[model samples]
Target: MTYRPATAAVPDLGVLTLGVEEEYLLLDPDTGENLAVADQVLTTLRGPAREQSRQEFRHSMVEMVTPVCADLTELRDNLVALRRSAAEAAAAAGARLVAIGATPIAEPHRSVPDKPRYHAMSRRYGPVAHDPAVCGCHVHVGLPDRELAVQVCNHLRVWLPVVQALTTNSPLHDGRDTGHASWRSMQLERWPSIGPTPHFESAADYDRTVDELIAAGIMLDAAMVYWYARPSAAYPTVEVRVGDVCPEVDDAVLVAALSRALVATLADDVRVGVLAPAIRDCLVSAAHWRAAHDGLDGELIDLRRGGTRPAWVLVNELFATVTPALARHGDLEYVRTQLDRLRDEGTGATRQRRILERTGDVHAVLDDLAARSRAG
Candidate 1:
C-alpha cells in the first residue's frame, strides 16, 4: 500500500491545529477484563452523527481521533464528545472502556481479535507484537513545513522520553510490577525501529531514511517508521507516539496541551535560527532510565546544563520556557492547573501502584482505571 505524506503547508504561525488520538481497550463491563468486542461497539456506534470509526489490529482495542481543534477549548470539547460516545456505546453492549498505556495483565494466549491486520501482526511480530494489552496516547500538532517537521523531530528526540516520563500510566503488566513507569515503552522497544528517532537534517533526508529502511526489507513503507516520535503518515501533523495510554481523560488533555506548546516553541526557535540543545545519546538514555526507574519521583538528566534535577523541576522549566506562547495561546491557566494536579495527585503510574497496594485486588485496579477514564 502506498503511504501518503504526513504533512501539508500551513501559511502562518497562527494557532497550530492540535488533536489527540487515544487507544482504548474493550472489556467486559462486569469482569473488567479485556474483551474482543470493539467490532460490536463499532457496529453499534456506526453511522454516527459525531465521530467516525477506523479499523485496528485488535478487535479488543479501538482508536478515536478528534477533529482538528483550533484551540484548547475545541480540543477539550471534541475529546469529551468522543469519549462519551465511546463509553455510551461500550456500556450499551455490556462492555467497559479503559485507558491505560498497557493493560495490567492481558494474556497473549487469549484469542487474537480475529482480524486480518491482527493476524498479520501476530505472524510478523510474533509474541511481543501480538500482545493484546498494549495501548498508547498519540498527539498530533500542526507543522508549517516538512523540512521544519524533520528539524522539530530531530530536536524532539531527547525530550521524547521526558514526555514519556510525564505520561507514565502503565506500571503494572502481566499482573506484576514491570519495574518501569511506562512498561509499554520498554515492551515496544523490542520492535525494530522503535523508541527515540534519530536526527534528520531535512525532509529529503527523512525520505531517504525511510526509503533505505524499506529497500533493506526492514520496513514496507513510511508507516513502519514507528519511532517514538514520527511524521504522521496519515495526518498533516507530527505525531508524538511516545506517551503511554493515559488512565484519565484529563491527563490525556494535559499531555496533548504540553505537546502543542513544546512543538510551537520549537518551531519558533527554528524560525529564529536557534536550534535546541544537543544532548548526547548516553545522556538521553540516562534520562529514559531515570523516568522508567523512578517515574515522576525520579530525577532526570538535564540535557542542556548537563546535570541532574527532579522531573518536576524539569517540567517547571519546560513550562516557564513555553509560558509566553502559552499565554499568547490562552492555554496558560489550563497548563498550570494540569501541572499542579499531576504534582499533587501523582501520575497514573503512581496511582495504579497506590490503588493495588491499598485494595490488594487487581480487579479493583482495573475497575478504577475504567471509572477514571469516563470522568472526562
Candidate 2:
C-alpha cells in the first residue's frame, strides 16, 4: 500500500503516541551463527502473536512493531510483551534471539531468507544486500502539524550522531572490528536512499522532494527516504531510524524516551516562538564523525556551542534538558533509571565487548544477550 502524509491541522502533538519496530537476527544458540529460521519459528508460535507473522515479510528476517501506544506505560508493556514472545517463539523453533545491532558471526554468503521482498532487495542491491546482518530500533513520535514535522527533521539532522554514539551496538561485523562502532549504519549508508535529509520549508516542499526522487528513479516513494530522521509516510510521526538495535529492552526504552522527549522539547520550543540558530554542515559532519569514532567514549561536537563535549556529558545534558518533558509525560523515573543504568553499567556495545573479552568466544556474547532477554 502507498503512504499518505499526515495533515497539519491536527490538534496539539503533545498527546504523544509511540510506535517502535525492532529488527532481530535469527541465531542458533549453540554456534552463535546467523540462521535463516525466523519463518519456522513464527509458524511454531501460537496465539494472537502469530498474527504479526502474517503482517509482513517474516521468519528469517523478523520485525515486531508495537501497537500505537497512548503513553510510555503502554509502550513499555508492549515492548516487554513483544520481546518475551519473540524469545518464546524462537526457542520453540530451536532457534534463539540475540538483539544486537548486527551479528558478529554473520557471513556474506550465509543463506538469505527466501521472501519476495528480500528477493527484490537482493536483486536490486546485489552483494551489498548480503550484509543484511544489521538490525535497528526505530521509534516514531507523532507530528501534530506537517509543517512542524519538516522543522523537526531539519533540527534532527544535527542530533542523530548523538543517538548513534549512545546506541553503538554493532562493534563487530563478520567477527572483525570493521572500525565502526555501529557497522549497521555504515552498511545501510551504502543504499542510494540513506543519509541526512535536506531541510524542507514546508509539507508541500517535502512532497515535491519525494516526487523528484521517485521521478529520478532514486526511490520508489517516501518510505524509501531512509534518512537518520524523517517524516513517516505510514503515520503522523517523525521516525528516527538511526540507532543500532539495542540488546537490552531497557536501553531501547531509554532511547525511545529520549527521542520522544527531544522531539517534544523542540516542538514546545517552537510553540513558544524559540528559534534555534542555524548549525553549520561541518558541525553535523563533526558530530557524525565523533559518534562513529568514539561511540560512548569519544567527544561529540555540541551543535549549539560548536565545541567538543564528552559523549556522556551530552547525554547528561539531554537528560537534564528533557527532565520537565519527561515529568509531563509521566516517564521521568523510567527515563532517569534507564540513563542511570547506562551510566552505572555500560552501553550494550561496551558490555558485549567486555563479555567477549572475558570468554574469548563471540558465542558467549550471544549467550549473554539471550540470557538477559529471557530474564526480561
Candidate 3:
C-alpha cells in the first residue's frame, strides 16, 4: 500500500486511526481440543467479512483484521460483527471459536497450514513451529512516516509491560497451570527476534538491524522481526504486538484505545523535538518478564525509579501519561470505565484461574473462554 507522509504541521489526535488484528483458535466444543478446520470455517464467511479474515500459520487458527477505524465505537462494532461472523462460521464447520492466548489443554500435535511459507517455516523452526498454538492481538496505529514510527516505538518501549499485564489470558498451558500469566509470551520468546525492540537511532538503523537478522538466517524476512513493537511491514503504522489475544471485545477495545492514545502522545513528543529516554535494554527485558510472570497481580519493575512497584501503580501512571491524548480523541470516558471494569473483574488470566480453582476442571476454563469469545 502506498502511504503519503503527513504534512509538516503536527496532526490532531483524531487523525490517527486505529486497526486491530486478532488471532483465535478453533476448538472442538465437546472435546475441548483444537480442531484443524480453518479452511472449512473460512468457506463459511461471506463478502467483506471473508476478505477481512484469513488462516494463520496453524490450520487450527484463524485471524481477523478490522478496517481502519476513526474512533473506538467504530472499531468495537467492526470487531463485534467480525467475531460474530467468525463464531458462526466455526459453528458451521463443527468447531468453536476461542479467543484465549494459548491452548489450555495439551494436544497431540498441531498441523501447519497447507501453504509453502508455512511449510518452510515449520521446516526451519522445527519444534518451535510445532509447539502448542498461541494467539496474540496486534494493534496498528496510523503513522505514515517510517522515521516517526521508529521513534514512536522508542517512546512506547517502557509502556509495553503495562499493556501486556492488562491482557494476560494464557495462564494455563499443556493441561496445567504454567505459573505465568502469559505463558504465550514465554512460548514466543523462543524466537530470536521476539522481545523488546532495541533503541534505534533512526529509520536507517532499524532497517539495518532487520537486514542483518535476515542475512544471518535468524529470520526469514522483515515480517519475522517480531519485536513487541515495530514499524509494521504490511501497513504504514506502528504495530504493538505485546498483548495476548483478549477474550472479550471490550478488553480488546480498551487495549486499542490505549494503544492509539499512546501513539498519538508520543508522536506529539517526536514533533516537539523530545528525545526518547535512554533506558537500558536489559532492564526493559526484565520488566517484560515480570509482566508475563505476574500479570496484574504482582509488582512490576519500575523503569523510572530503578526498583519495583505494584503493577496497578504503574498502570495508573500510564493512564496519567496518556490522559491528554485520550481526551483529545474523545476516548477518555470509555477508557476510564474500561479500566475500572478491568480492576474489578481482573485480567483474563485471573478469571481463568478463578474458574479452575472453583471447579477444579480444565475443560470448564475452555468452555468459559469459548462462551466469552462468542459473546462478542
Candidate 4:
C-alpha cells in the first residue's frame, strides 16, 4: 500500500528521529469478521479536532501515524495513545481493530469508496484491490540527504530479508495455515513494484529510474514504487515498508528502533568512506523469500557473509553490527529488551498458530489479536 504522508511541516531533527505508521484490520468483536468501519473510526478520532489518522486501500483497514519523535518512550506513548483511540472508536462503532499481517478468514471487500483516486486505482488494478485484508508497519527515519538515503537503501538489501524474518506475523490466509511465517510478504510480491530495489548510483539516478517507470506505465506515480526501502517522496526520511503490521505495540517499537539505528549506522559508514557491501537484485529476492517462509524458526540467507545460517545467528550478527548506532541514540537496551520479549512470545505468526491450537477455532486468532492490540 502506498503512503501519502501528511504535508504538515516538521522541523528537521537529527538522524535518530523517527516516525511509524501501522495499519490495522477492523473486525467484529464477536465473530472475528472484517468490518468496514474506517470512516467511523476516523470521524471519532476527529471529534472537533484534527488527527493524522487516515484511510487505506480497504475500508476495513485504517492507518494511525505518529509524529516525529526522538526516543523510544515518546514513540511508545504516541503509539499507545493512537491504538487506544482507534480501539475506543471501533468499540463505539460496534467493531474492533487488530494489528496483524493478514486476515485469516475475511470476506472480500469489493466496493470502492467514492474517492476519485481509489476509483482510478480500482479501475487500473481490477479485482486485485478487492482482495482480503492485509496490514503492515512502515518506519520512517530521518536522513541527512537524498544521496545518503539512496546509499542506505543500497546498503540495506541483504538485511531486508533478515528484518522480515524478525517481523513475520501473518501466518494464515483464507482461513487456513499457509505454512509460512509472513503470508502477506508473499501476497505483496504479486505486485510488480513491491520488492527489493536495484542499486542506484545516486539520488539523481534513482529519480530518473522512477521517471522511466512512470513513463513506461509500470508505475502510476512516485507513490506507486513500493520498494521495501525507499526515500520517502513526501518527506526527508527513508521509509522502510517491509515488515507486517506487528501484533504487539512493543513489537512495532522494536522494529522502528532497529530501522532507525540501521539507517544511522549505514549513513555514517558512507560518510566515513567505508565500502558498502554489494548485493544483486536476484539474491535480494531469494533472501526475502527465505525470511518470509521461515522467520526465525528456520534458516536464513546470511547476506553479508554469503552463506546460509540460522535466523537467530543472523539476528545476533546484525545486533552486533548496529550496537554502536543504538548506543548513539540510547536505544541499545530497549532494542535488546524488546527483542527478547518478541522471541519469548514468538513472532505474530507463531502466536497465531498457537491461538488456533488452543481454541481449536480460527476466529480465536482474531479475537486474541484484538485483545492484545487494545490492551496496549
Q: Candidate 4 local accuracy as lDDT?
A: 0.83
Residue-pair clashes, model 3: 0
**How do the residues 69-143 of candidate 3 rate in per-residue lDDT, one tens digit apiece?**
999999999999999999999999998999999987855557787798888888889888888889999999999
Q: Which parts of model 4 have CA positions greater than 4 angstroms off?
A: 1-15, 47-50
Candidate-wise lDDT, in order: 0.76, 0.75, 0.90, 0.83
For model 3 the local lDDT of residue 324 reads: 93
Ranking by TM-score: 3, 4, 1, 2
List, residue by residue over 212-274, the lDDT tens digit for candidate 1.
Answer: 987986665678788877778887788898888788777888888888888887776666566
Superposed model 2: Cα runs more than 4 Å off: 1-11, 53-59, 108-117, 280-282
Return whichever of 1 and 4 wins on lDDT.
4
Query: In terms of TM-score, which candidate is strongest?
Result: 3
Per-residue lDDT over 11-72 for candidate 4, one digit per residue giving the tens place of the 0 to 100 score = 23344789999999888777677888888878888542127687888888889899999899
Using TM-score as the measure, name the better of candidate 1 and candidate 2: 1
Give me candidate 2's TM-score against the actual structure.
Answer: 0.90
Error of 3 at 172 (Å): 0.6
Alpha-carbon deviation at 222 in model 3, angstroms: 0.7
Model 3 scores a TM of 0.96
Q: Give the lDDT ranking, best first.
A: 3, 4, 1, 2
